[model samples]
Target chain A: MSQTMPDWSVLAATCPSRTSLARIANKWTAMAVSVLGGGRTRFGDLKARLDGISGKVLTETLRDLERDGLVTRHVFAEVPPRVEYELTELGFTLHEPLLALCRWAEEHIAEVLVNRESYDAR
Target chain B: MSQTMPDWSVLAATCPSRTSLARIANKWTAMAVSVLGGGRTRFGDLKARLDGISGKVLTETLRDLERDGLVTRHVFAEVPPRVEYELTELGFTLHEPLLALCRWAEEHIAEVLVNRESYDAR
Candidate 1:
């Protein structure tokens, strides 16, 4: 059987789990982590892939993800200096569950939209 | 193999999947669904379980969840009138993945918090 959250798990006001979920729940963070799925990616490239994210949002998202331990940022001291991002092991675990959520969203998007329209019309 | 989202999956502006994800990603909705996991739950019970959500927020969240096809509302025609909410099959599927996320958050909250504190000090 799959896991069931304990009664007080996320209900607690100070639960970090709630904060943790919030981190990935933002689509920008979710997509950023998605892009890094293949392997580590450069900062410029990660930003490029998101396409719709503002530079500030992307910067903040990456910093937050790194701070949350879901992503790691590497900086090299070469002339041009290199900065790339990768998922930590903890991040990979999160990515799997998160990807499942994204897939569910895509597959059921039509039903959800139809339901929304009718519900709103009432 | 686990499902991987398509390249353009969540990157598009018109993606309903992103909207759907956004709906449940809100902690209020997430916790509400978690409470209803046992079976059908009444509005008062669900609201009480969440503890911190405003009456307005609970109303809005339930309406949104119902609209998105993740939850069903049943109104019993009686003197006082009765209403209960239960997960749809689709919602149940979502609950599984989401519970995993909640569990992940609780289990690793400490690590993430430590990472955050250290990251901020730098």
Candidate 2:
């Protein structure tokens, strides 16, 4: 049987929770949220911050975040129709855990690379 | 300009860290770590435990985790040869954060689904 401790589980065959997992954990989502963790910004500005993201992808990721209720989208009815995206209180919860993984990636990347080489050599 | 605050930045184009991000944030990696977070097990057991994973996919994920130094594989050269997998200290670090995400997935999946339906209908 799958080892499911009381408080958590991803072991079921047909759990909606597994579907939810796909929502929060993605490269674009992680990057976008990390950038947004500091604060909210406009779509164009947020796109600039994330380096290699395409405009299309940035829109999709933001849409996903908004759908998940982790982000809020505000449209200011002005000359250019100003819009801004910010994390909701729910979205803010992701900051520390996501940062932990990012920090892990940054700090232990060399070790991972060396291990990768070793595995490849084998 | 990209809003790169002092400490963290997924904001740079030519960063090796960008490469590192891909390594850590994969669907399979997250699943495997969550399952293995409980304890070690044999290949058959783990595969059986995870509900919907193909054997080939599980092997690849475990190999990736091992290469990243988060998992250790042991082979006992007995009559038939037994294999086991266990988490390293680094892997243990993932338990809490990973659990947090899993819990969030469980608790908020209904809301996420509602949001998805709303987004899709638009």
**Which one wins on TM-score?**
1
Q: In model 2, which residue pairs have backbone atoms overlapping below 3 Å?
A: none
Question: Candidate 1 at residue B46, lDDT?
Answer: 82
Query: Ten-residue segment with the worst summed lDDT in candidate 1 chain B?
Result: B5-14
lDDT of 2 by residue, A1-122 (tens): 89663343456768877776776766677778887898879988898888878999889888878887889999999988888999988888887777666776666666666877887787
TM-score of each: 0.86, 0.83
All candidates: CA RMSD in angstroms?
A: 4.9, 5.5
What candidate 1 gets wrong by more than 4 Å, as runs, is A1-8, A78-81, B1-8, B77-81
Local accuracy of candidate 1 as per-residue lDDT tens digits, B1-122: 98775443665656667788678666676677777788999888887777667889888888889988889999999878888999998788777766666677778887887998998888
Shift in Å, residue B56, candidate 2 = 2.1
Score residue B107 of candidate 2 by CA lDDT. 74
**For candidate 1, lDDT tens digit of each residue in A22-99?**
676666766777778879999888877876678898899998898888899999998899899999998887777666
- Give the CAPRI class of candidate 2: acceptable
True-vs-predicted CA distance for residue B66, candidate 1, Å: 0.9
